[model samples]
Target: MLTQLTISNFAIVKQLELDWRNGMTTITGETGAGKSIAIDALGLCLGDRAVTNVVRPNTKKADLSATFDIKKNKPANTWLSQHDLEGDDECILRRVISSEGRSKAYINGSPVPLTQLKELGRLLINIHGQHDHQLIVKASEQRRLLDNYAKHQNLIDDVSYYAKKWAELTNELERLQTSQAQREAEQQLLQYQVKELDEFSICEGEFETLENDYKKFSNSQSILEDTLTTLELACDNEQFNILDSLRQCVDRLIQYSDIDGDLANVSTIYQDALIQLEDASNDLRHFHERLELDPQQFQVIEERYSNAINLARKHQVSPESLHIKHQELLQALANISGDDSRQEQIFVELDKTKIDYLEAAKRLSDSRSKAAGEISQLITSSIQELNMPHGQFKAHVSTKEGEQLSSHGLDDITFLVSINPGQALEAMHKVASGGELSRISLAMQVILADKVTSPALIFDEVDVGISGPTASMVGDKLKQLAKTTQVICVTHLPQVACKGHQQYFVAKLTDGEHTETTVTELSEQARVKEIARLLAGDKISEHSLANASELLAS
Candidate 1:
């Protein structure tokens, strides 16, 4: 759930910090008091498009951030882990918009693209604007919502896979029907390339081995001569070798230890040195015996290494990558061989893939057809309770049997509604009243609440055109939704504002030159006064306070 929000220089809000709690909370104040500031700030953190106007006057930039607790949000934590961004149970998303309209986003303090921020935001918070009903008119949007409600992602994925396969095979079939001469020419070229690489036969990891061996062999003479010279000086010399000199010094030191006190310490050092020199000479003699360098091997290695380099240059690749290129050419050659037979084989495969796509699409269509009716009835029941007792709703799933296949399936889903008893059901956009659309949108959201997996839900003036018991119905719906997740609403209606588990008052403060908007969480006594004000226009009389108190009790 959303845990905290901090805004700096955003719109009229110079600085604000809000600590959010679970369940439904309402924000209410006089008109133009910046009641929507919290929603706007959260949208920016969620990667909403930003412009210079969002920055407060005389401010260089607008900064916004939101924190979410994701310990129980598996999808969010999984996404973070997949992207190497996982941390503690808390996830903080931040955004900074400069006055020049340039913006930057960060997740967990690491700079990220807006696309990533938006993707993560979808899993944390969902903000519903007053005009979201306008988006419900798009058929694509309708389809997405219905699909989410249907919860048959596996069926959808299967249809998509088969549709994609069908497309690939169709394109291949068209290619196979093209000119035969071009195909033959392409085959001949691939054959020649494959033959060249085949003869070279540079196995994996061989390029590095070849280089190492070449370096070792080319310097064999110097390595052997130097080793022999060092061996003779260190141990082979009878009169002046290092081991013999160290031993003589050790014997002299032991003999003079009693004569000088400092010489006693020097005797121990000489003895240790004698031991170390003896061990070093023995190891050197062992290494000298194992050293062997072929006199004629250098020329063979030099030629092979040169040829490898030339092959790499001809192929336009590094010598170390030549083995990978060889494998790629080999696979291409295999794919290009026997074009005529392959074309015939593709014709059969294409038919099978087309059949598979249609079958899977049919299955998905059936699942949607079943889910659509259940959702339609659920929404109808909701709208009837939202002051449209006689309203009718239906999700029409029109499946095209012989039409072109789509990645989503063969169904065209549309939402039809009628807000009056004698009215004919029609498309939502064709209706006249914005208030009716708002109610329908709310009804749909209420029915499909489970589909919105985000931990927090925010409604900005969603009850704009509602009043009386209808506003109370809307509040009931929001509070009911809050049973599963946190709900925050900004509203003017006392009926809705009074239904919150907690309430906040949005107020604008000004002296002369500067103006700022602030949000304060209201106490019990304060809530009564505020609700009374909402009920009776800036006045809190005794009767209004009594009514407010009674409403709170209920």
Candidate 2:
């Protein structure tokens, strides 16, 4: 429910604030008095396009805001919570347009994108302007309305889900079939590569170890000669052997040890040196005995090292990464082989999904067919009461042949009507005049009032081209709709204004230099005079006043 609306410097509305209540609230004024300014302001707050010209001539910007009570509106409350914009029990939507043509939107005082504001606005209010009558001409809009009336939202969702799944599977199968021959040739190449890699069976760190062994085998003779030379210098040579000289020096130092403490220290040092030289000679002799050159082992080590380097280059990878590359190739091969099997499985699933989609669509179509009859009867009865006594209304639901599955199912729905006895029923847009279309729209809304979840409905000029008894009937229908939800109507008919539980009068005020539009909530006497003015065209006579009173009384 819209609880309040505020407009500042918007068009001719200098500053205005109006409090609203549930039930029918009628707005009336003379022509050019800006009766529709309130509706326009509401549109601005509901994310309508803003223009600089809408700002008051002397003002730099226009501010518009609307407050909605959503404590009982589950869909609106859910939307607020989902978008992280939930406030107390009320939601405030605000929009501001600067003279430079820039605009900003806010929800609950927090800035939001324009699209978010529009989405939430749709859930909170339904404004049925005179132009909305043209929407009946669209086939898609017709489908939407029929589905909404039938409450087939869940079925519609299922059809959408399955349709998307079917498209995905079909595309995958097509792609696989297109590349079947190329994949077969690639599979043979992968097999040969796998076999060759398995033959080498390379282990981590094997390349480095092979290179080390090859180095040792190729330099065996040089290693043996070097070790033997080192041994002769340390202890193996017969002349001037280091170990023998050190032993003789130690014996000479021991003879003087009793006479001199320094000589005893020197003898200990020489003895330690002789022992180290003897150990070094023994190690060299052992190394020389082990250094035997084997040509066959050398040849094997060289061949393995060369093979590793060449293969690493061939695969465009370092020797250390060869193992990882092998695993990657194996995975690629497995995926290519798996595609054929996966394609067959997808075909099976695609068939099942198509069946599911068709079954769901059929159920929806049946429900629509049943609902068409009931809706047509209800609307036909409603329009007759609105003064179209000879009118015939039908909800035409027909199956679309050879149509691919879609989110809206397979039914093409259109509303057909005829306002005379001899005329055949034709599409509502082609057959109904502007006035008849308004009445027809009103009838449909009256029948579907309970089904609509929007908390507020605004009817702008729905009584256009309608007057006399038919105008009164339109007023009564709007009043009936207000019983379940808030109804705000901008009307020029005295009968409709008299039917309102509350009445507001819009008028233009001028201060010589400027003109501004103002709204006044009418008291009993004020409402009577306004209604009289509507009836008498700016000259309220005694008869008009009395008529207004009687209309209000009724």
Candidate 3:
């Protein structure tokens, strides 16, 4: 339900803030009092196309915003959750249109696209104006209304799931059918590549180890010469050898050990150094013996390294990535091997899914067909009470070989009506009088009241062509709907406005030379004055006030 609306610099409405209550709220004022502007502002907030002309002539921008209570609207909350928005019970939607043809939309102060605003609008309010009355006549729209009325959540879910699967299968079939030559060429190339790779029998890490060995073997001669020279100077050379010098120093230190306590420690260090040099010399001699040069081994190493490098370059990958490419080619080969079986499986599954989905859809259609009869009877009874004694209303459900199924079903549903006796029933849009359409709209709402999820239903002059007893009944019907859902209406009829739990009056006023529009919620006394004015003229006569008071009391 809409809790509040604030409009600024929009057409004739300079600034207006309306606090709306739950249940039926009626807005009434004189003609040209900017009532349409108020509705237009609501439409703009609901993502209607914006025009700079709708803004006040001298203003930079026009702003329209409203707050809605979604405590009872679970569908809207789920939609919000899907969009990654916090689903508070209260939601505020705001829109601003600039004179420069720029518009901004926001939900709960966070900026959003107009598309999102429109999506949220569908869940929040359903405004049935003249255009909407015409929409009721369309068969597709009728089907949607019936589905909504029936609250077929499971059927809707199943149809959507199957429709997506059907679409995917159709796309896959097209790809496979149309790309046959290209796929064959790709398969041929992949087969040749896989055969070449399989003959190699390559192992992971082998390339890196081979390269390391090649580097060591290539530098072995230079390495051996350097290490041997160092070892000779350190131990093998007779006079200048460090190990010989260390032995002489140890001999002198042992003699001085009796004179100094630390001399023995120095002698032990020299002895350890001599032992380490001897072990190093022995290891260097073994390394020199092992460093034999082999041209054949070097050639083998280089040839293997070149093959790895050439393959890496040919494939536009590092030698390390050869393994991954090998696996990918093998997987592609497997896919090609199972291509026929996969296609057959998809075809079989597609047929089975279509059958399953059609069964569910048929079940839904059968239920709707039964419900349609009941709906026709219910609406006819409701409309007859509204003074359309000769009115004939019917729900026509037709099934054809549809091109595709929709979220609703494969069948088409339309509302048929005949205004006069002996007249053949036609589509609902063909109805001429505004009064009849309002009655029909009311009848549909009455029948669908239980299944529609909108917390608030707003009627913008839906009672336009109705008057007298019919107007009073429309008001009563709106009041009845208010028990389950909030109902708001804009009307010129005092009877319609009188039935509201809350009443608002939009009036044009002049502040100095400027003209603006203002809306005020009427108190009981104020309502009497307003209703009396609506009954009579600008002057509220005593009799009119009495009549108004009587109407309110009743």
Candidate 4:
């Protein structure tokens, strides 16, 4: 339920605040008295597009806000919690439009996007303007209204889910089929590359080891000669061998050790040097014996190294990266094979999805067919009471063969009407006048009000082109609707205004330089006088006042 609306700096309304209650509230005013200004301001708070001209003459911006009590509105409360903008029992939607055409929206004091504001507003209120009757002519809108009345949302959701799945799988299958030839051509090249790489069997770090071995084999002769020369110098050479010289130095130092203890340390060092030189000679002999100068082994090592370098160049990678490239090629070949298997699986899934969509669509169609007949009968009976004595309404539900799966199912619905007896029924847009259309729209609204989730309904000038007993009937229907939901109507008809539990009067006030609109809640006596003015137009005679009194009394 909408609790309050506040407007500031809006066109013709400098500042206004309205507190609303849950009942039938009627707004009455003369021609050009800004009766609809409040409705327009409320629309702004409900995320309607704002224009710069809506701002007051000298104001920089226009501000509007609507407060809704959502304690009993589960959909609205869930929406607020989902968006992280929940309020304490009250949700306030605020909008600001600047003179420069910039705008901002907020929910519960937290900034939000306009789309989210619009989404939340839909759950809060339903506004039907005089122009909304034009929507009766649109086929899509007709289907929507029927579905809403039917309350088959669960079946519709199933159809939508399956249809979406079907589309996805179909698209994937088409893509795979289109690329089949290209994938097959690439498969041959990938297979050849994988085979070649597998035969190479490159190991990590083996390339560097192989290169080192090749260098050692190539330098074997020089290495062997160098080791023999070092051995001769250390011990094998008979003249001036290193070990013999070290032993003579050790003998002299040992003799001096009897005179001084420091000489004993020096003798120990020379003896250790002799032992180290002998060990070095032994190692040199071992190395010389192990060294091989085989030309055949060297050629084999050279060829292997060359082949590795050539393969690296051919693959456009370093010798170290050969193994990584090989693995990648193998994976690519595996994916191509996997795609063939996946294509078959997708085909199977698509067939299943199509079946599911058809089943759901069939269920939805059946439910809609049943609901359409019931709603059409109810609306036909309702319009007759609204002064259309011979009015007839029908919800024509037909099926289109070979139609593709859609979110709304495969039913084509159109509303047909006949306004005269013995006349054939034609499309509503072709047969009904504007006034008749308004009545039909009203009848439909009355029939669907209980099924609707919106807590509040606003009718703007819905009584246009209606008066006398018909106006009273319209008023009675609105009042009846208010029994289940809050209804606010802007009307000029005294019959309609008199039926409201609460009445408000709108008038324009001017202060020489500026014009503004003001609204005032009418007292009982004031209400009678206003109705009298509405009856007599600017002059309230005694008879008009008496008539107004009688109208109120009834």
Q: In terms of TM-score, which candidate is strongest?
A: 3
Clashing pairs in 1: none
Cα deviation of 498, candidate 4, in Å: 1.9
Local distance difference test scores for all models? 0.87, 0.88, 0.82, 0.90
Task: Write model 1 residue lDDT over 1-554, tens digit each, in one string.
Answer: 99899999999999999999999999999899999988988998998889899999998999999999998999999999999898799999999999999999999999999999999998888888888887888999899888888989999999999888878877777887785778778888878888888888888889898899998887767777877787677667876777777778888889889999899899999899878777877887777677677656767777878988998999899999999998998887777676678889888987887789889988998999898989999888998998989888888999886545689999999999888779998987886378777888887776666665668888989787788999889988998898998899999988889889999999999999999999999999999999889888866789999988887777
Greater-TM-score candidate between 1 and 2: 2
Candidate 4: tens digits of C-alpha lDDT, residues 1-554: 99999999999999999999988999998789899999999998888988889999999999999999999999999999998999999999999999998999999999999999899999999888878788988999899999999998999999899988888888888988999999998999999888888887878787898889988887887888888887777777898777787888988788888889988988988888888888878888888987877788788878878888888898899987877888888999998979989999998998788888888989999999999999999999999999999999999999764536787888999999999999899999999988899899989887887676579999999888787888889999999889989999999999989888889999998989999999999999999999999889998899999989888887
lDDT, model 4, position 315: 88
Model 3, clash count?
A: 0
Best by lDDT: 4
Model 2 global lDDT (CA atoms, 0 to 1): 0.88
Model 1 weakest 10-residue run by lDDT = 445-454
Candidate 3: which stretches are off by over 4 Å? 1-17, 36-130, 238-289, 402-408, 431-435, 510-515, 536-554
Candidate 2: residue 408 lDDT (0-100) = 73
TM-score of 3: 0.82
Off by over 4 Å in 4: 192-331, 511-513
lDDT of 3: 0.82
lDDT of 2 by residue, 1-554 (tens): 99999999999998999999999999998789899999999998998988879999978999999999999989888998998989999999999999988999999999999998889999899888867667766788777777777887888888788888888888899989999999999999988887788888777788878878988988888898888888777777898777778888888888998888988888888888888878878888988998888889889889988888888898899987887878888898999999989898998998898899889888888999988988899889989998999999999999863436676777889899999999999998888998888888778766766675668999987788788999999999899889889999999999899999999999899989989999999999999899888888778899999999988988
* Minimal lDDT window, size 10, model 3: 130-139
Instruction: TM-score for candidate 2, please give it.
Output: 0.76
- Count the clashes in each prediction: 0, 0, 0, 0
